[model samples]
Target: MLQRKLAALLILLPSSLSLTVTAQQQTPSNPVAPSQLALALPATASLSTEESHKPAFESSSAEGVIRITPAPQLEKELPSQRPFRTAAFGIKANTLGAGAELATPLFGRFNLRSGVNFLAFAYPFGIDGVNYNANLHFKSSQSTLDWFPGGHAFHISPGILYSKNTVSSAATVPAGQNFTLGDQSFINSVGDPVHGNMSLAYPRTLSPMLLLGFGNILPRNSRRLSVPMEFGVAYTGAATINVNLTGTACTNDGCTSFGGNSEVQASLTQEIHKINEDLKKVPVYPILSLGVAYHF
Candidate 1:
């Protein structure tokens, strides 16, 4: 029994030694170094230094914080859009007579306007004491600073009116025709035909104008055209009348072409007095105007 057992051990020992040699020849995929095994972890389960610093995406299974970065947008590089700033226009009986103006946007919700106007009209009339054929004329330049208190669509305008207001007249002591002086009618200065040239002017060339207006003649935000309306008062000073006489006045002899008679002078003075009374009723003029404007 002992001899048989010794032979069996010899055969198994050789086989076991051969298997050990084969395992040593092949390299281990998960070899453990001193540092890797220090934390009591398997070598195959350990992380590299770089891998340890990386953020983990697996929720709950990993312990780490992640950061996200956004890309830039192209729209932010585009230019900004803006509104209209200036305009030109033709205006009616407002600041300037019948003329034109230019408007420009000033600071916030304000507009500055400048322009000139001219107008002339003729009329035939007979007052109880006066005979007259006259032309009324107005020529002026104006400027305004407008404030849009409500909106750009409505405005309060205070302006400067620089104007020449006049009335040119021709009158004659009606030969056979009755002439009205004021309340007095004169067929002739004493009894002969008399002729005179008359002109009326305002003492002030500059006046104050205030108006409440509507419509954005030149619009900043709207794309359409606009029509504006303005109504106001112009404070024109007292009227001055000038009269020049020629040809026949009251004379002891009769009506003559050139008469320096005291009667002639007295007649002229009376006529002037009557005319002055007629002007006293008006001092402030009413202003109304309509305008169309376009912007670019």
Candidate 2:
């Protein structure tokens, strides 16, 4: 039995040695020395350190490769904001317009406006006179001024006015009687007249006013509109004070005043003086008006 076992061992030992030598011949060479191997060992161990600092993605097909990006860092700062602005503009009677201010700037927030107001029946009136009973006329003029302020739409404007007021004075004096112009036989003081003369003359008046104002602001979507009325007194006259009233009714002749002899001549002379005195004394009257306006 011992001899047989020794024989089997010899055969297996030779086969094993041959297998070892063939494996050694098939293996590839190491290119590194002992010191190079030590250096290479550290480089291999440092792979974990490189991976910790890297972007954490790899081309290799690993078993469990997870990617995570930490929450973004947010800044802690205040936001930006802007402020509001004031407003400025002008308007006319019942519309937005530009006009000259006959009066100066008052109340800081107040402004005077002068423009044409083309509205029928806006200011209608009739007057009875000596020659004409009642003259009826339609007044539409080109000269008028308005004054007011932005707040509450309250304003006051006083300037020259050219309006026509007519009345009718047609009647018979009932066959010679002491009936004056006011007598019912001559001209009744009731309604307007039909066929009468209307004159475009200067009249003095104070215009206190109220209005509706509208406005718009672009940069900021803001709007303002209001209806405001105001009452005040004004005098329409010249800033300078100077009077000159003297004239004669000369028929196609180089005028000459025939002294204080002729009653007609004296009456006419005194009439002109009276007119001068009236113009000298300023008329302070109350005024009230209502209108609409727009602001932009």
TM-score of each: 0.63, 0.30
After superposing candidate 1, which stretches have Cα over 4 Å from the reference? Answer: 1-85, 93-96, 180-185, 189-192, 249-259
**Could you say which candidate leads in TM-score?**
1
lDDT, model 2: 0.35
Q: Write the per-residue lDDT of candidate 2 for residues 1-296, one digit (tens) a residue.
A: 99999999998999999999998899856556777776666443646555666674542122333566677899642111021123223233422112221222223334443444333332333322223233334332222233334433333344443333322334322222221212121222122221222232225333333333232111122343433333444343421221121222222232333232254345434544454466456544333433333333
Question: Which candidate number would show the highest lDDT if scored against the true structure?
Answer: 1
The digit string of per-residue lDDT tens for model 1 on 21-60 reads 8888896858998865676764434444435666564222
Question: What 10-residue stretch in candidate 1 is worst by lDDT?
Answer: 76-85
